[model samples]
Target: MSDGERRDMGSKLSFGRGRPGRTAVTLPDCDVPLAEMPSPSLLRDDLPLPEMSQPEIVRYFTNLACLNYSVDTGFYPLGSCSMKYNPKLHEDLARLSGFAQVHPLQPIETVQGALALMHELQGFLAEITGMHAVSLAPAAGAHGELTSILTVRAYLEHRGESRHKVLVPDSAHGTNLATVSTAGFQCLPIASDARGNTDLAALAEALDEDVAALMLTLPNTLGLFDQNIVQIAQMVHETGAQLYCDGANLNALLGQVKIGDLGFDVVQMNLHKTFSTPHGGGGPGAGPVAVKAHLAPFLPSPFVGQAANGAYVFEEPEHSIGKVGAFHGNFGIMVRAYAYIRSLGAPGLREVSENAVLNANYLLACLREAYDLPYERRCLHEVVFSGSRQRAKGVHTSDVAKRLIDYGFHPPTVYFPLIVDEALMIEPTETESKETLDAFCEAMLVIAREAEEEPELLRSAPHDAPLRRLDEAAAARHPVLRWQREDQA
Candidate 1:
C-alpha cells in the first residue's frame, strides 16, 4: 500500500507478480492434476502462467502499474504530442456492459448500439472537420496519414495521373514526410520562412503535376497555425494536387474551424489527441480519416454502420481498400473518443480548444521574455520556444529538457520540426490550473537562472529521476526486458 514497500529502487521496476525478490506467489514445483503440463507441440500446451491468489495477483499488478508515469499521475507536456489527461469517465462509458461484452463479429441488429456510436462518431468527426465522409479505420495518426495519402493515390490514378511526389514542409512532423516517402512517393521539401510557417515561395516552386499532394499539419510543429492556409490550399489545389490536413492539432480548433471548409481534400483526426484517449505508450490509437464524398469509395473496409431500423452494422464500401485492421479501428479508443464527444457536446468541445489556446498563449507570455519565441504568432494548442538563449549559455534545448526532469516536470519534445534551432515545444493543455502554470513557470525561470549560473548542472541534470542519463550505446546494445520466475521453473 505504501511507496517504500512497493517499488524496487535498484531494478527500476516495481515488486510485482514475478518481482525478483518478492514473496508474490507460492506455487509448488510439482504440478497437480489440473496444472499438469501438456506437450510443447500440442495445440493445447499450457502457458507458463504463475499461480497466485486473487489478492496477491491484484496487488502485484496494482503496484506495477503505479511505477508507470501516466497522464493520470502528473503533468506530461510532451508537445506536438498532446499528452492531455484522459478522463476516467470516458473509460467507464467505454466499458459499459452493453458495449464491452459484445463481440466484433456479432450480427448487425444485435450490436446496433455500437454501430450507432461509431456512426455518430464518424458524423461528429465529419462535422468537426467539415468533411463529407469519415473512415474510422487507420489505427493511429501516421496510419491515418497513410490511409488518406493512399486514397489520394487512388483518386489520382483514376484520373490517369501517376504522380510520384508529395510536397512536405521542412517543419512538418517526421511521421508526415516518412508516411509520404514510405507510400512510394518522393518527398519534396518545402522550407519554412522567417516566421516558421511553410514558405509559400518554396511551396510554389515545388508545385507541379508530378506532385501528388501537399501535406500540412494545421497548427504545425512550430505550434503556430499557418497564416496563408487559404492561399496555400488554393495554390496546392491549382496544380491538381490534393491537400491533406494532418489533424494532429485538431485539439486547438475543434469547433472553431473546419478542415473541409479550409480546402483540405483529406484530413485525419487523432481521436486520442482531440477526444481524450490515453496514448497507450505510443498507442493503440484512433486516427479516423475524413474525406470528401469523391474519396469515400477508397476508404478502408468494414467501417461501422447504422441500418434503417436503428440497427448498427459493419459494411465494406463498394470500392474499398480492403481491411486495415481485424475488426474496427481500435474500437475501445474510438469508444473513449465518442464518449468524450458526447460528454462535451459542441459547446464544451469548443471551450476545450479555446482554453487550450488560452493556456498556451498564457505560457507563451510567461516565457517570451525569458526564451525566444520561434514564431511570435497566436499559437494553437502549443507554443514552440527556441532555447537559443540557453544555447548562448553553452546549453542546448536537450540540456534544458534534462534539467526540467530534476524539477519534476516531463520535457517537451526537443530538436523536432527540425527547423528552429533548439526548439522547446510546449503545450500546456486546458486541463492545467493557473497555479500549476505559475509553478511550472517558476521552475522554468529557476532553470533559466541555473543555465546562467551553473550550466553544468543543467547540462548533467535529471539527477532526481529514478535513473540519471543512460549510456545510450550500452542501453541500445543491451536492453533488459521481462522478469524470470525462478521459483516457478
Candidate 2:
C-alpha cells in the first residue's frame, strides 16, 4: 500500500455514524429509581462527542500512534533537549507497586521507604553536582530555573542586599531570560565570543553590586564548554554576586566536572535530561536544585534528609523558598532517575558522558564538510551546524529538517539559540549505536546533496509524513485546540 493511502485511511476524523438512538454499548437497566435529571438550564445541550465501540476506539488510537515519531522508534538528535532512548528497566522499576502506589500526601512515618529513596537520591545528586544541598521539588527544567533564581533572591535578601538584576549569557538556555523575569529580576544579556564562549570582556562590564547572580549553562546551549568558567565564577564572586548554573547541559559533564566545584553557588539539574526519563510531550520532569552551604537554607522546602538516629525524614530548611511542587515533585520521574543512577554507578556514569561526547564529535566530523560549523571546535554533547551553505541554494534549516523526516528520522532542532544563521542543532545521545549514527550521517549527506541538486525537494519536504507541510505560523497564532463539528464551526 502507498504511504498516502495509509495516511488517508488513518485521517478519517469521524469513526462511526451518529444515527439517533445508536449506542456503542448497552447499559444495564437501572436497579432502582433513576435520579432526577438536572434542570435544562444547568445542563449542556447537543454535546459533541465521538461515538465508537471500544474496539473501534482502540484501533483509531493505535493507528494514530503509528503516525507519531518517538525515541523508541528512531534516532532523535534534538540538540539541548537530550532526546536519549530511555532504558526499559527503569520503567519496570517505576511500575513496582511499592513505588507506584504510595500517595504523595501519606504521613511521613508511613512513607519512610519512599522518603529514604528520595533522601538517598538527594545525596547522590549533591555528590554529583558538588553542592551541599538538593531539592526534589520544581516540576520541570524551567521550574527548576525559576526555583534557582528565587533561591538566589531569597539568599540575597536574607543577607541584607538588594540586587535587582540577574545576568544571563546569550548562549544560555532559552528559558533563562523568562525565568529571570519571572523571579522579578532584570535579565542582563552577556555576549558570546567568536569561539562561542561567554564574552569575558562583556561579562566584566556587566557585573556590578546590583547584580544578584550570573545564570550560565555549562557546555552552554551551543554545546561548547566555557573554558573560562572558573575565571567567570571568580569574577562574579568578586562583585559579591553568585553564579547560578543551569544544568540543562549537565549530560556533557557527568562525572567529569561538578558545577559546585567550578565555584557556582547554585545549580539546577534536569533529571529528565541527564538522568533517564521519558521526557517528551511536556510532562513528568524533576528539576532538583543543588546549592552551596551558604545558600542551602534558601532551597525549596521538604527535601529528604537523614535524622540523628539514621532514620529518613522530610526536613524543611529554616529559610526555604517554599514548596515548588505538591510532594517531592513527580515521584515517578524520580524513580526512573534513581533507577538509572543505581544501574550505572560512578564509573558507568562517567562512561555515559564519554560516549555521549564521542558520538557528538563523531557525527560532527562526519557532517562538518557538508554543513558549516560556526565554532569549528570540539563540541561536548551536541553540535550546531549552520545551514547557510544550503541556504545560498534556497534551502533553509527547516527545509533540511523536514527532508530528514522522509529519510526515516526525526529532525534535529532548527533556528535555536537565536545566534547562528539557519542553525541546525543535533545531539545524538550516548544511547545511539555507531551503526545508527552512520545511517543518520548517510541520510544527512544525501539530503545535503539533494539540497544542491534538487532544492525544491527540500522546499516542499516530508511528503512521506502522515500530514503535509503546514502553515506553522498560523497554526501557532490561531491554534484549533479542540475538535469542532462542522455545524458548530
On TM-score, the leading prediction is 2
Task: Note the residue pairs that clash in candidate 1.
Answer: 112-312
Q: Name the 10 consecutive residues with the lowest summed lDDT in model 2.
A: 14-23
What's the residue-level lDDT of 346 in candidate 1?
94
lDDT of 1 by residue, 227-309 (tens): 89999989988899999999998898988999999889999889778888988577889899999988888888877777677
Error of 1 at 408 (Å): 1.5
Candidate 1 Cα lDDT to native: 0.84
Best by lDDT: 2
Error of 2 at 475 (Å): 1.9
Which segments of model 2 are wrong by more than 4 Å?
9-11, 15-22, 38-43
